[model samples]
Target chain A: MVGLLDYFRSAAGAQKGSASVAKERLQILVAHDRAARGRPSYLPKLEQEILAVIRKYVEVDTDAVSVTYEQEESHEILELNIVLPESSARS
Target chain B: MVGLLDYFRSAAGAQKGSASVAKERLQILVAHDRAARGRPSYLPKLEQEILAVIRKYVEVDTDAVSVTYEQEESHEILELNIVLPESSARS
Candidate 1:
């Protein structure tokens, strides 16, 4: 069976954590902190949809990604650090 | 200059992390997840007060020691693992 580290090192693991952190964090904050590394955005409706997808397909820890956004000189980017649940890592 | 590990080893640091995590998580979550590890609770009023105090004195990262609650066989407990910012720790 594939384990977490093995998958995290793989290509898919890297990108996914960044993207999902935003989603997980937002849901957590009762519709707040919808920041993708300081992006200007809001979408409860879209977020709900995404949550649906995340829930159905992935068993995200919400703990691992613990996403947060930051403001830099000019650009906005998504920052996430999700650790895939060992179970999810397999599929 | 004492760093995180030094303080964490101290008694104060250990207890505070668990308690603060509950506070930090709820605020960001937009009035959500106020669980003392499965205990019955709804604390918007108290929470706001705590936030006021916390913001006043400490520069809480609101990042590290991300708090969460858990449900067990018969009891509820708060779970927090806050990482004190270097600047704040100095004071």
Candidate 2:
């Protein structure tokens, strides 16, 4: 065997310490970035804030406000969108 | 001294072929999935369609629909969001 180095192999760099630490650091940094760029730092707080903000203004007909993680060029961007009851206007 | 293997250190794993190849494959697969899931795969086509769809439905005050890459659970998800002129309703 030429020594498989992928996730399927034993030496797939899947070691707990190194890779896990790396992943954690990366995620935390990303989360921080999102927070800085007007995204909620924590998931729950973000969800709450998003709903609160949308509900404060628009007449929401459906529950579609959602938050998810996305990596872009090693940076994460948080998106917030809502579906409002059509009243014929754009604000 | 232990050898450094991160992107910052000496053995920075930033080798063109392997890392670039992996990124390419991942991007391709992700783009394919986006196409299957009702997203325009190519940037140009997608932008065109997005504009077409929005224009046909609403009177646009500003352009808002945008597509970008987001990483989630080792996979990338492309999000499409349109900030139409407050014309409400979830269709």
Candidate 3:
């Protein structure tokens, strides 16, 4: 099946793990990093969008859904965390 | 076969995308981030190690290999780029 590995293979070709590809990836990652330095005005909109996506399946603590990015040594990750309330019945 | 997917699945089970996981990942990524902020005195040693790995395969421009860290938003990337000379014979 076509997946991330396939994409990487097609993207890198014979120059897999080349310096140029690394630099390009870094440039993109850094650009996103710089944009998210502060709380930023669009944070609310983003949060709402995430909440909406989660709300579609089940009720959840809106505040519990957090969307963030993370990077470490060539690993650029988009992290999403959501928490739902206990299954107890509401009074 | 055991791959990254297996590793990630094992690492995060029911709380695969939970905020706590996000925070943990961020902590680890950021630690690496802060450590790489400066050129760091050990850069030369790292370069030598990397050059040695590449040298095992082909002769390359020792100066061409560059290692750098980039941070964006929540993305931290370890970027490594190397350039090699052409195949032309030396005079």
Give the Cα lDDT of each candidate. Answer: 0.31, 0.28, 0.32
Give the per-residue lDDT of model 1 (tens digit) for A38-69.
Answer: 33332233233333344443466655544444
Ranking by TM-score: 1, 2, 3
Provide DockQ values for all models, in the order shown. Answer: 0.06, 0.06, 0.02
The TM-score values for the models, in the order shown, are 0.24, 0.24, 0.22
DockQ of 1: 0.06
Candidate with the larger TM-score of 1 and 2: 1
Q: Write the per-residue lDDT of candidate 2 for residues B1-91, one digit (tens) a residue.
A: 0111111121122332333322111111011111112322233333344344334433443444444544323222333434433322223
lDDT of 3 by residue, A1-91 (tens): 1132332233334343343322111111110111122222222333344344334434556465444544333233343444434431122
Question: Could you say which candidate leads in lDDT?
Answer: 3
In candidate 3, which residue ranges exceed 4 Å CA deviation? A1-91, B1-47, B71-76, B88-91
lDDT for predicted candidate 1 compared with the true structure: 0.31
Each model's interface RMSD (Å)?
Answer: 18.1, 15.8, 19.3
DockQ of model 3 vs. true complex: 0.02
Best by TM-score: 1
* Model 2: per-residue Cα lDDT at residue B70: 47
Clashing pairs in 3: A19-B81, A33-B72, A33-B73, A69-B74, A70-B74, A71-B76, A74-B78
TM-score for candidate 1: 0.24
Specify the CAPRI tier of model 3. Answer: incorrect
Complex DockQ, candidate 2? 0.06
